[model samples]
Target: MTIAMGEKIFHHQLVYNDYAKLSRNFFNLGSLLEKIFKTTFLSKSGTQEGENTYMGNTGNKEIDVQGIFSSLPNVPTALFQSQCVVWKDEILICGGRPHNHHCYSYHTTKRKYKKICEYPHTIRIFGHVVVKCESDNNELTLLSFGGVDVSKYTLLMSYQSVWEKSRRKEKKKNEWRVVHHDTSFGTRKSNLTGASALIGGKNKDLLFVTYFPNKIDVIDMKTYHYVCGTGSNRLPIKSPYSLQNHCFVPLTSSNQTVVNHFLLIHKNLSLLIKYNEEDKKFCYESLPTCPSLATCDCYGFISFNDQIFFFGGYDASAMTEIDYIFIYAMKDRAWTQSKHSLPIPTRGCCPVLIGDGRFLHLVGGLAHHRTQAMHLATTVRAFDQVCFFFFFLSVIHLVII
Candidate 1:
């Protein structure tokens, strides 16, 4: 059974699958309610305003609004497979599909966008990775590398003190500096269309790049050189299977020992990659399968507390997009379907955590209809504020039965 109210949809099957095993013993009601209260209200830091800030009910009608989905300003252009990184108070959107080269900086507080710079004229923008790295002098730099472009080298563009200049109306043209054009890294096309990149290492000076099938590349941020040699920059562990449209998210845990761990997800398969600092090597461990894997693809994910939330994606078997949001708890090794969903079926949209990690800002992608081959470009921005308190209320109602 399904219920639709306003823009939200609730699936009875999902709720039943999760709560069907609950006992009907009324004596256990107190313990059950205690569990629900702790899980819904308390955050990882044991504070009411931390990671689970959105879940609290302050009794203020104006401030208590939760799980609300609203539209924001449209992007200057339709884009997907783009790269976004949070830089200070602004979000730098760079390199997307349709051979786009333009880059823009969206100010979070001002809610406005300013065209900053463009990718190199000779490079293709689609499927690229843009990340903030520190220079040798401890200055911040934006490093872009690995895309559909068959370029054999990586590029770096420094934006140090440029934001202040732009504010003062004295902006200067941004230039790309070729960091590594060495042909010795091989002439074979480095087409990392659906890859993931993150900054890691003991000193946080290493860039870890992972591409489809099974390949990992490590680069020294300061020197802008690819790390090579025995026990080299590449990880020796190999996967028995292949994955596409995957995502790598750093594990969010209170334990300090797991700080160097990352969770890699693709469909139902989830792997835990641990960075062994002693040997400077990485290893992987398989985790429980994701429940929504059978119907989710190209989804965006972000970790909070001990749970990972998956946003909209496509269902290849049905050839349709999905608005369902699924949550996987790392502690319980279980999945729960979110009662709230996106306003529309969306795919390939970038999911960004904003405002104390309570709200999710979804950028450009594609919106799909029920029928196949009918889709529209998602130019308008969407915001998803996750407040699962309503789901808790429904569970309470069921307990009364």
Candidate 2:
């Protein structure tokens, strides 16, 4: 290549005052964390993997499996989002299912957990959501919204069921309030996939949710007034889409809250979609395929260091093991493997972004009951052991490869 006379310029790597500082600042390095970030990966049957994959902090602490249905010998579990968020030095986990109701906070530094408050449901089954509420002090308020009533035995109900249930419980009345303003847009059947973001709108932090049925909606959060639709002419489907799994991440064109771009993680296909909000449509980009990974069954995502991280979900073939975490870098427009693995085999568990920048945490999902017969915390255990054993064998083909 020839340069054009005196107008030519030589290109060189731009030098910064401190290479180490810039390197550390631009990438996610887990070396700074002070606690053990470990979780168990259970096949639907809850059997321990012959070899445990060590996770954050390297597996050297006590696990707080207290009061949970863990004593069951073998039980089928639900596939739902678990929000295990960390703020500063504390980790907070909120609502999931059966006995997974109520919200709790943990001190990573202390390595202990304490229940902060009961979530809207006592016998909570599903459909709990969390979002940044417009509080004066910036205290995050988790929304205890509608969910499936295992008791309903009839058809799935509308979004209003959440408001009705909360009213009856009347617990956390001071801390929790109704999103009374927006429920007026008629009943929506969307159970949310991930947490809603309080993104910048006419105001700095309006709430946005990726409802399960394949659509997006925004609410004033404070006023509970419908702000508008996001990313396209049609909204994504609402949650529990017995048909599809959907995920969303609000991207930036300017400051972080800028809504011109969105990162959508397809619920089950292991595809990450980029939507251009200004053009009012999704971009025509092929999804990066993780042959060993399946997106069709993932729980959540975390974006850090210019790449979005996808963690545990069921293996691609319905009958495979649910035991790994995958990472995809945006610069290369492809997916790769993460050095991390779930503490145990897990499917239908929730993955949440913790602290900020690079830290993330994983919590409860349905796991199988452990059994050796020779060794039982007791004999007549709970859940179902036979179903779980078959569930494990079904997925062995996928994992062996």
Candidate 3:
């Protein structure tokens, strides 16, 4: 008999053995049935090579087994502490450790990468932050700040020019230009290393920068100057220690109490910072402690569907890499660990969400190792959140057989 489910066709055959033989194996019915079901499911599922399916329960919900992780093509070189920004259908990957200057754009649909442009001779690209800001004219600009050298220069590149340069159609000598040579926050020089930048404000003209030792700075994008007259740029509530290798993700909430809000994530802290339009200052409220706070750092962090997902990271105390996937639900303010982990433990990888928030692409990072600095990773893995209908089909088939 032939059965069709979606685009896949499955053929099944039933064989009848002698009644005497069946009676002799009556006590083995459970084992015999298990074997039959396993064979039937594996043959009909049509799982491809290098792909894996997992079945289990996560708390009250049944884990999405179809939403599995699979490897993609390796990047051109192994990289760690790199930065990536999604632009249209491509992910533009910038510099990483080992003094890398080359940048490439990974085509999400084609699953290939093409070298885009190299950083200027003066800039060190690793540990930098890249953000996409759209101007009033609807033109997109890519802004880069901070790096390993703790450079004070801010770089800006035209998105259109970058695309044209990638196609070899532009004749410009340098694609990136130095926008500000002495960018600073109040009395202190900007610490670009391990810093994070986000575009905010009602007009989207303000750039919020969160940097080391718990400091926040707002820069006017139009004039490229730090706003200081309204209030001090530093966070009113300071962390116990300096924050390095931290990240800032904008929070989306239905609450109307604040004009702008963001979540600051670190190894040991999670704080909610809100902008007060009336006071022209930023205030913060501490959230629950991170579940993997003691064991993870330099991991992949992203916000999707009101949830924060943390990928693999290095455990400094244990001196080993971790492969656990931790997720925090924003609505419930609770953390749940996913049964699924990376194919291999990695740290400092770039995570990009594409295609309707269902496909998460994890780019290069440092693989599992004892040393803290070496061993750049080259693998790219993707987690596909397959539809629940597909999982329903598999359950139905198992019950019917």
Candidate 4:
């Protein structure tokens, strides 16, 4: 019912531009008017009329106009070195510092967040690992492990599932239950926050917690007991592979009785270690070094589209943030850098793959701004790499050219 004067003018200009082909002067005026219209209202961050380049070399790239900082909702707190896990359609945000035990869950479909129950402990975890676990009863749970507890030891907490058959509630609240705690694998000995995951086992799932300086502990889910001894003595493999601050991912290529193989990524070494049941030994394969940097020290990685995407970490010497995004194609055994960078320089950020793995949603982390000191970043960014319509249009325009 009410239209602004600028809206009326824009409508008139659009109508005139549709008929501009009738005259030369009209075409020139219409083109000028269109430029004015775009500059006045349609302009956004990282959008240019010509080609744009950021970093990496993943073909013809453009700044994701819709994937800017303003497009995402801010986290409740500016958190870095926090734990993030994707459960079904929701994302769980766990403990982090400046020392607090608050937790949150973000509903991806609703695009809203709700503060969930806090962690069982009062202290904060420095570098924690959180994972989603499912049981044989078809129930889902969350397991959190590792991280420095300061005066206290490292703690292992699992969500107490309330999946009662008689209770017919659509939504249920879960609480963190202390499953295991020990001094040997705790904070005094190691700040065990390297890489972790819940792999499928014979009767239940097994959680593999990797400690610093190359050590792993396998915990049985059903009993919440260590499969072997505590600390470094519990690890299955005695190889000299020191899995310092690295990322551990499991690969399941077969449906056989044996469990999945483990992939470890430390500096200069990308090894795929699998357990040989018959020989009772661990087999390790050295993968090709994909890029020049040859490592992702404090970076984050997630398996997407059958590939591993490594992004967001800081360079140690200069203490500067990194914007490099690399992708390792599993089948092709090759690596390619993406031509786009983060919205800003970031480290300790969590990259979660959503919906068919075309878009990567980067969560909270530490960022360095030119005007201020390094601080926890509250901004979120989405990277849209699948240029479906743009690619088709560009191909058609190229043939015409």
**TM-score of candidate 4 against the unseen true structure:** 0.65
- Residue-level lDDT of model 3, residues 254-285, one tens digit each, is 42212468888777677888886557787778
Question: Any idea what lDDT model 4 has?
Answer: 0.52
Q: How would you encode candidate 1's per-residue C-alpha lDDT over 1-401 as one tens digit per residue?
A: 55443355645565454343432332254335434444443222333432222211113212111233433444666676567766666667776766777777766655567777777777666556667776443235787766543553467776643456544332333555677555212227655766777788778877777776666666676676676541443433345434446677777655232556777777657778777656767777888776666646777666766777777788877888788878777777777776557655666767666555544566665563311111111111112111243444566788898
**Per-candidate clashes, comma-separated:** 0, 34, 1, 0
lDDT of each: 0.58, 0.41, 0.62, 0.52
Q: Which stretches of candidate 3 lie over 4 Å from their true place?
A: 1-67, 135-139, 148-150, 161-174, 181-190, 236-240, 254-259, 370-401
- Per-residue lDDT tens digits for candidate 2, residues 1-401, read 21121222322245444544644432122211111111222111343533222211113432222211121121112224554544555555555654455555555444445555544343343544554433322234444454432211101111111212234533443243434432532134444433334354544444454544554555564555664444462343334433233445554332243343556656433333344434434443345556665335544466655566555565445654365666665556676654435444555555544344323345546444221101001001111122222233344545697
lDDT by residue for model 4 (80-188), tens:
6667766656667776654447777766655557776777665446666677765334345666666543533334434332223385434443556555453333435
lDDT of 2: 0.41
Where model 2 places Cα greater than 4 Å from the true spot, the runs are 1-80, 122-127, 135-138, 148-174, 181-202, 228-245, 252-258, 267-289, 352-359, 369-401
Candidate 2, residue 118: the lDDT equals 49
Using lDDT as the measure, the top candidate is 3
**Candidates in descending TM-score order:** 3, 1, 4, 2
By lDDT, highest first, what's the ranking?
A: 3, 1, 4, 2
**Clashing pairs in model 4?**
none
Clashes of 1: 0
> Which pairs clash (backbone N, Cα, C closer than 3 Å) in model 3?
146-192
Cα displacement (Å) at residue 218, model 2: 2.9
